[model samples]
Target: MIKAVHGDITKLQGVSYICNAANGIGPMGGGVAAAIRKAGGKEIETEAIKVCKEQNPMPGDLYVTHAGTLPFQGIIHLVTMKQPAGPTSYDVVRTCLHNLVAYCRKQGIDKVALPALGTGVGNLDKAKVAAIFKEVLEPVKDIEFIVADIDQDFIALFA
Candidate 1:
C-alpha cells in the first residue's frame, strides 16, 4: 500500500530504507541531505561520496549506501539534479523514482520512505512532484511506499 503522511523522514518507522534528495556528486550539503546526515551521522555522507566516486551518478541516477546510524537498513541517494542550483525537470524526478523502485526490488526492500524529491531546494511544485511519484510508483506491487513530509501541502497531495 502507498500512503502519505506528515512526519520526519529520518524518524520513519517500519521502512526498509529512506531516500535522500541528493546531487550528482553526493555531498549531503543542505535540505533533506543535511537532515539525513545530521541524524544518520557523517559516515552516511562519507559512504555516499565513496559510491559517487565509483559510480559517478548523473542526474536521474541513484546510488545506495548503508544508513549509518539511522534506523533503516539502507539509504537510497537519488540524484535529482546535477548541480544544486540547476532547475529540475519532471523527467528527472520520474527517472529517480524509477531507479529507486528498481533498486528496492533488487535488494528485496519491501518498504521505503521517500521525501518530496526536488521540492526542498530545487523549489519544484509539491503537487507536481507528488503526482510524478504516484505516476511512477502506483503500479508497483508489494512494496509499501510512504511519501513522508512535515508539510501539510505535501501530505495533502497524497491524501
Candidate 2:
C-alpha cells in the first residue's frame, strides 16, 4: 500500500495520517505545514510544539503529535532546520526525510504523506529532491509514501 501519489494534502480525504514539513520551531506556516494547519486547526500545532519541546529531539530528529484540525490521526514533525552542520539545510533534506520515514516505520505506521522539504525555505533543486526521496524510500515495503505538490507543473516535474 506504500506508494507515491500527486494530490493536495490539505484536501486529502479518507486517510488516517499525513506528515507536515514542520520547521524546528514547530509552528504552522505556509506550504504543506500551512495547508495542514489550515485544514486541521491550531490544535495540531499546539500539540506538536508541546511534544517536540518536551522530547527536544536534536536536529535531524523527528517526533509525532495529534493532528488536531488536520485529517490524519497524527503529524510527524521532522527537524530539518537544526541539522548538525548548520541551517544551510540543502544536505539535510534526504537525511531528514529518511529519518522521518524511519521514525514513522518504527511506530508501525504504514501509511503516511509528505511534502518536498528544503524546496521552500531551504532552496534546493527539484530533481535532486525527488531523486533523494526515491533513493531513500524505494527499498522500504510497508510505508505508503504520498508526495503532495499543489502546483500542476510541480507535480508534472515529479511525475
Candidate 3:
C-alpha cells in the first residue's frame, strides 16, 4: 500500500529503509540530506561516503547504507542530480523511484519511507515528481511505501 503522510522522514517508525535525496558526490549539505544527517547521525554520512567511494553512483542512480543511529535498518540514498547547479529531469526522478523499488525487492525490505525526490534541492516540480512516484510505485503491490514530507504541496499530490 502507498500512503502520503506529513512528518519528518527521520522520525518515521516501522520502516525498513528511508530514502535520501542525495547528490552524486555524497555530501549531506542541505535540504532533506541535511535533515537526515542531523537525525540519523554522522555515521549515515560516513557510510554514504564509503558507498560513493566504491560505487560512484551517477544521477538517477542509488546507493544503500546502514541507517546508523536512526530507527530504520537502512538508508537508500538516491543520486537525484549530478550537481546542485540546476533542476533534475523527470526521467531522473523516474529512474530513482525505479531503482528504489528494485533495491527494496532485492533486499527483502517490505516497508519504505521516502521524501519528495528532486523537489527540494533539485528544484523539480513537486506535483510532477509526486506523479512520477505514483506512476512507478502504485503498480507494485508488495512493498509498503510512505511518501513522507513536511511540505504540504508535496504531500497533497499523493493524497
44-64: candidate 2 lDDT, tens digit per residue: 878867776777766567777
Whole-structure CA lDDT of model 1: 0.87
Instruction: List residue ranges in candidate 2 displaced over 4 A.
Output: 1-3, 83-88
Q: What alpha-carbon RMSD in Å does predicted model 1 have with respect to the real structure? A: 1.2
Q: State the TM-score for model 3.
A: 0.95
Measured on C-alpha atoms, candidate 2 has an lDDT of 0.69
Candidate 3 vs. truth: CA RMSD? 1.2
Q: lDDT of each model, Cα atoms only? A: 0.87, 0.69, 0.86
Using lDDT as the yardstick, the better of models 2 and 3 is 3
Off by over 4 Å in 1: none
Sorting all predicted structures by lDDT, with the top scorer first, yields: 1, 3, 2
- Residue range 1-159, candidate 3, lDDT tens digits: 689999899998888789999887777878888899998788888878878988888988999888777878788998888665456888998998899889889989988999998888677888888889889999999998999998988898876
Provide the clash count, candidate 3. Answer: 0
* Highest lDDT scorer: 1
In angstroms, give how far residue 123 of model 3 lies from its true place: 1.0
Q: Candidate 3: where are CA atoms >4 Å away?
A: 84-86
**lDDT by residue for model 1 over 43-127, one digit each (tens)?**
9999888888889999999988899889888888899987765677888999999898888888889889888988887888888
Higher-scoring candidate on TM-score, 1 or 2: 1
